[model samples]
Target chain A: MPHPPVHSPTILCTVDVVLLTLTADGLQVALLVRDRAPHAGALALPGGFVRPTEDSGTRDAAARMLREKTGLHSPYLEQLATFSGPDRDPRGWSVSVVYYALVPPMAPDDGAPAAVEWHPVDRLPPLPFDHAEIVRQALARVRSKSQYSSLPVHLCGERFTLPQLKLVYEAVLGERVNQVSFRRRMDELGMLEPMVGETVGGAHRPAQVWRVKEAFRGELSLSERVLAGRD
Target chain B: MPHPPVHSPTILCTVDVVLLTLTADGLQVALLVRDRAPHAGALALPGGFVRPTEDSGTRDAAARMLREKTGLHSPYLEQLATFSGPDRDPRGWSVSVVYYALVPPMAPDDGAPAAVEWHPVDRLPPLPFDHAEIVRQALARVRSKSQYSSLPVHLCGERFTLPQLKLVYEAVLGERVNQVSFRRRMDELGMLEPMVGETVGGAHRPAQVWRVKEAFRGELSLSERVLAGRD
Candidate 1:
């Protein structure tokens, strides 16, 4: 990192990522036990100090940290908020730009950082520092946007049946969505593309499978209806 | 600002506010001509460095700076986005926590800091550094959120008739809105309260005046219909 003049002004800048995924049980977040000071050995969101010499943006730093700590490459990552204050860190003035990332279900990686684990977001153990509050904010953001966006699709497998996709959305929204209405909204969003030769099997029949359009995978799809709010 | 140990990490931290207000011409932003290095004698958004000792949250710092520099105490302020990169600051690594604030229509303050002025947002002259880019992002955020949120109400007077409020929304949205539907949407939002004793007389019969309910002033009231998009 480049150093400023002898008399300089600087603050600690780091990027913290909330890596969220849908487990068989429910929504979960990746966390790791800190091995360094401030709150050593406490479970916290995976994060690292942003390298000024290398990172051009906080998002790049967040992606790098998630890859290093969790060994998973996420499809959807959006900035949640920036947590900054004099008291947030025991060290001097510090700012942690927080991000929320999403990925499909997968087995734990062999290359994952030691001490890292996935914990149900609702049943998370007490986390270190302000991490617990960070998780709460991330959950609120994801749930709120899920009402009008295709964010929950990131939690589905690469190719998924409509029933499977609807279930993912319901899990994030915590509500029963009508099938016809959900399909209508999906068509309006124009974010899904059918895999012509693909099908997912079930006992009664084989359902046609689809994947999110490449353009919509990393962006939000605004809806005309207020799915969960007063409309 | 406190400095860390000789080899400790540090970055330049600042709080830049996009202070927006309603004007007869259109929405305007508060900007001040720069008087210091890097981009001296150029128009820039009203902002200041974050003081570690006196500031705990970035929002507090933004409010303080807006108060100190623009002579305005904004009622509605929200964190917009963080602009950070190595090249953002010519002097060193910098992170600017940006915020967007709204104020009721009023005459420009005489107490505004020297060199400060209000520029019509749509006809803004070229700004220094990346302030223009910041303004662009701020405008997009404001217009997009206005589609469903009760944000443009800040551009209205303390006591305004339904017609007056509708005009404010239309101006911000850059489109014509149907009166019957606009009123219906406003009622659905439940963010306005009719003033029992107030009326505004115009060419037409006197219309009842309303003010945003206190509870809704600091919160977003969501709606299903898009304010500016095809409806």
Candidate 2:
């Protein structure tokens, strides 16, 4: 007779976050040190188990994980991708629903998780598991999203200068951009509006501050014209 | 005493597919009839367990599962999302990684260990597990991707007419498109070129056939102008 299966079937679910924030240096990501049994003592994306609740869905689970891991509630959170491989975790076969979150940079509390730290995206340390690969994919999606959508605004404060916005894109895409072309594109998209009372500090030519159009909030709609030839 | 903390805990991992194809009626999806074990007899996206492989990564595993289940090869596949909840799989704690795939409208032999059939997206049957919800999310992503990318081309044959191409978009998006606007957008994107030796069969007019542009072959690149809203 054939041997019966050994273990009781179980579903292993967890949430992982790609928390992106804009800093003076450039775009940065928050990473946490794993303190528990699986992958302990390694730098990884902040995440945790999904809790059972009446109103909690996948998005809610992601939000909960973000808050628990980073102590910051981002205004924008979207599902990035899911990662599951038989050998992804040595402990067992676990599947993780990954999310990409955008929030303004903030200081972590003193009592926060001991291993958590903000690392500039370009100079990231070795991440645990497939996290480094996850981050890379998330970054590519973010860069692609920022180009056609108003997502770049999420990386900056409510009030920001054009130069600041340009810098965010440059950092995320890892390249230099032409200011004239970038401004022209922004104007055509109607994504930005000149702020009434703001200007860049400490510059011979004070750059005008602009805010993302409030009416254009939420996810940007993909337009036919934009799809045609606009990047 | 608690069983001395059992070592080498086992977790279940499964692969789910969001198989999309373009047909005359519209975009359709392939679902399989669950025949054995959990969710038996219910219609579900075809899925199976990951096998042990030394060189297989997550993508490779997904591709293998897809090929074995659907008899399709080299289809456009991407990680959609992961569904891992304690109660998601009644058999036990199961973790499933969902992948979205785009295949042209050609019937392939069902190689899965289950009864499989294609159903128009709008008339999908009740699905097993939380698969209906996963399909909905995947469809939404496909629609979004189709708007800005040449992704819909994947739903067509190696060569096709402009009308056939337009119909693919109409079916996937569930909306009628203006002929002039659609053609203009296609031309502007450099997605296709008129074929010299072919003509579409029709009662009223002999329309010219078109092939996907040579330059637009392989994975399409997002244009900076399109990204920056210069159209």
Candidate that would win on lDDT:
1
lDDT tens string, model 1, A33-71?
Answer: 888776788888989788888888788889888887787
Q: Tell me the number of clashing residue pairs for each predicted model.
A: 1, 15
lDDT of each: 0.82, 0.71
TM-score of chain B of each: 0.91, 0.81
Per-residue lDDT tens digits for candidate 1, residues B111-223, read 56555688899889988657889989999999888888799987777778898888888888888987877888888889999999778787578899899898887788987
What residue pairs clash in candidate 1, if any at all?
Answer: A11-B11
Predicted model with the maximum DockQ: 1
Model 1 misplaced regions, further than 4 Å: A1-8, A202-205, A228-231, B1-7, B202-204, B228-231
Best by TM-score: 1
